[model samples]
Target: MGGNLSAQDEPASKRVAAALRGRIEKGELAAGSKLPSEREIASEYEIARTTASAAIRLLEQEGLVLRQHGRGNFVRETSPLIRLGGDRYSRKYRGGPTPFRRECERAGLTPRVEVLAAEQARPPIEIAQRLGVDSFTESVLQRSNLYFADDEPVQVVNTYIPWAVAEGTPLVERKQTGKDGIYGRLEDCGHIMTTIREEVTARMPDHREREMLALPGGTPVLQVIHTSIDQNQSPFEVTRFVLRADRNGLLYQLAVD
Candidate 1:
């Protein structure tokens, strides 16, 4: 927050935050570097302590800084790697149905689902193929949205389940259970998902998505297709996840012989 009084720029507090952010971005401040105290900033900038404090709050909200109770604030490290993919429905984190929420929480991220629309509909061709069912068969159509840090829409997932399997189950019944995972809820309803296979591809964004994701013209989306199966070896669900690559980093480990 320390700067000259005649700092001919936007607002004084914004100028201060911008200067600090620039320093951090340029590695001058670096991650984990403690910011100057409020009094020091006020003295250096010839501004009031309140201005210095306000600058910190703004940076924190922008995800540019982290404030620890007694440790003061520092630039937040860039978004963490998102590790996904694992054994399906093994009760790895929770014994009940949904463990995905637990996994996300353990990674220090908030997860929520907004039901866009859910009802019985014939499976789309691609989804029908993945689910190993006839395209004309009625399936449970569900759309759930996902939000990430800064309230950005990182992923939009559309899922399909056969009504015969998900009907009357928590998977079909939308709930406000913030902590429950859909997989867990499905298990609770006796679906007992046992495995999943996934496919991934990347492509340029179409006009609709560019607007929905608020992306510039050139950014591409990472498309993931997943088919999950039950213990009976029957395909249970098909999910298509469209993720914003800039905000999400997919992690995978490779083993070579």
Candidate 2:
């Protein structure tokens, strides 16, 4: 990073971060480029190492830099795989790659999914309410999937189906129930999807999620909860998507009502 040594209206940390951020946007510091150490930045700007570290932290929070354990900080990957919102479930997109795989291929990246677990588990109180199950001890069939792009884990999707609906179907299988994906098997079981309700929130990840997604310390995750309703106005399926805030984005295209 090269810039004149001078004071600005902002604080020293913000000023340093802005300088580095500008170069990153201009491609002067290309993707995956290793950033200078905090000590180096401190020496250059005549600021404390803490200030330098704070500046780097700012960039990381903005999803412009990546912090890897045992390694140094670097520019974040430029290309991110985007979720096509509700359109991903369109029946027209069936018979080929799932929405996730298609997004990776469209970005010229390889996509892979690992079925982590398929078992009946008792739903949490929050989940139980959404599934309309008894929170006391009722169980729901859960299929957990870990999606990756270029071999890096990006998100974990956990889909829950009532045991009454998944008891004897492929829904209990570890692999995809069908090329059309879970919704098809859902429709087969008479749970025809009519409306989808999605809610997105952001919060720090738990230890398991942090380790699963290989996320850095202090990074947050986007939690997208989806509820699929049937023709009878009953919520049949609920999926919780934990997406890496740094590597993923959600795009929603809705009609102007």
Candidate 3:
């Protein structure tokens, strides 16, 4: 039978996409399963190859499919979700695995982090404002890292600490920051970590981010601007995290008074 469509009123492209979308949602196609080629879909649907292509494009724009450069389109992978929450930063885990590692381990995935850069530098205007730095020319220690889960890139983290707070500290000399990650070192310098604030938003990824995350064209990145407050009610650290929307999730449980 040729073009055996369930509905004949809609455009040919949408009908084909709807049929395929049904299979995807029903688990008939399954995650990571390659979709039939446009030509194959056209043959099966008895529609023009261009119409078949348009159908596949619709699925891609909706994030239901991913097109590898050389390979074909496949359902997006949905397993091993790395979740972030307040518990990830618990002080009890300090002097050991970082938050990223702990979350990955909890999800039963291997974790890795690469320090892309660590140095003392002038802060951006927004970062300066967040840190309450008066002089933009004053230096702040910056640590840039790329986090991975099971060898797949997941997020980018850039941390900034005021020079007045970071100067003459272990944070200036070592990437590891000695123990307990940066919090332990900051506490050693007398900035007790007592509270945190995270502002989250979503936006389209730039070219560099797209390449770094190996994201498909229609994907967007989740931006989280994190601020750490100390016992003195001072914001000592500001971190900008760019996470892939597909591989990571957010969970927050707050107590309301």
Q: List the residue pairs that clash in candidate 3.
A: 95-180
The TM-scores, one per candidate, come to 0.60, 0.85, 0.91
Q: Model 3 misses residue 7 by how many Å?
A: 6.9
Query: Best to worst by TM-score, what's the order?
Result: 3, 2, 1
Number of the top candidate by TM-score?
A: 3
Reference-based TM-score, model 2: 0.85
Which candidate should be chosen as best, given lDDT against the real structure?
2
lDDT of 3 by residue, 144-218 (tens): 888889999999889999988888887876466656788888888898888998999999899889988888868
User: lDDT per prediction?
Assistant: 0.68, 0.87, 0.86
Q: Across residues 146-216, which tens digit of lDDT does each residue of candidate 2 receive?
A: 99999999999999889889888998988867667888788889998878899999999999999999987
Query: Regarding lDDT, does 2 or 3 come out ahead?
Result: 2
- Clashes (N, CA, C under 3 Å) per candidate: 4, 0, 1
**Model 1 worst lDDT run, 10 consecutive residues:** 95-104
- Number of clashing residue pairs, candidate 1: 4
Model 2: per-residue Cα lDDT at residue 186: 84
Model 1, range 217-253, lDDT digits (tens) per residue?
3356888888888888988788888876655556555
